[model samples]
Target: MTQLETAMAILMKVFDTYAAGEGKPDTLTKGEAKTLLEKELPGLLKAAKNQEEVDKMLKGLDFNGDSEVDFSEFVVLVAALTCACHNRCVKK
Candidate 1:
């Protein structure tokens, strides 16, 4: 597969793995989401100045106000982070 295709697959797989942890298999409960954050995106949590900031990040992910993160919400987080990193690197 192409690089983009591989990335897409990985994203779906990561979301699926975490979402299956609790509650519905198609969406992530807050606890499951937190676990995914801590494990899959440890650097992001480390970069956060404190737990408040991390909480805010997680809150921001639930765009639909449904108290859970679906695949689209997860993808938005990934895309936003990708853009932020790319912009920072390009500015260097």
Candidate 2:
């Protein structure tokens, strides 16, 4: 599959696991992002080594500086990560 398609699939999988049977779309709430940083990305997201660190990181990615992160921003963030991990992955 293409990188864009692969990234979307990975992101959807991540969101599904986070939603935990909620059937919710792939949107990232503040809490969900924090959990992802602290738990799922332990080594990758070790800014301050805690939830507060994750919150700070979230602020930077929120773009509009809004308290919550919508799917658009979340997708961008996930795409960036995918690209970082797999150099040629995800076309943005």
TM-score against truth, every candidate = 0.94, 0.58
lDDT for every model? 0.93, 0.69
Query: Please, what are the lDDT tens digits per residue for candidate 2 over residues 3-91?
Result: 97996788778766664533334555667776766667777775467766666778877788766666677678877877788976646
Q: How far is candidate 1 from the true structure (C-alpha RMSD, Å)?
A: 1.2
Per-residue error at 37 for model 2, in Å? Answer: 2.1
- Judged by whole-model lDDT over C-alpha atoms, candidate 2 comes out at 0.69
* 1-88 per-residue lDDT for model 1 (tens digits): 9999999999999999999988999999888989999998899899899998988888889999999999999999999999998998
Off by over 4 Å in 2: 1-7, 19-26, 47-52, 85-92
For candidate 2, the clash count comes to 0
Query: Model 1 — TM-score against the truth?
Result: 0.94
Query: How far is 44's C-alpha from truth in model 1 (Å)?
Result: 0.8
lDDT of 2 at 26: 55
Q: Clashing residue pairs in candidate 1, if any?
A: none
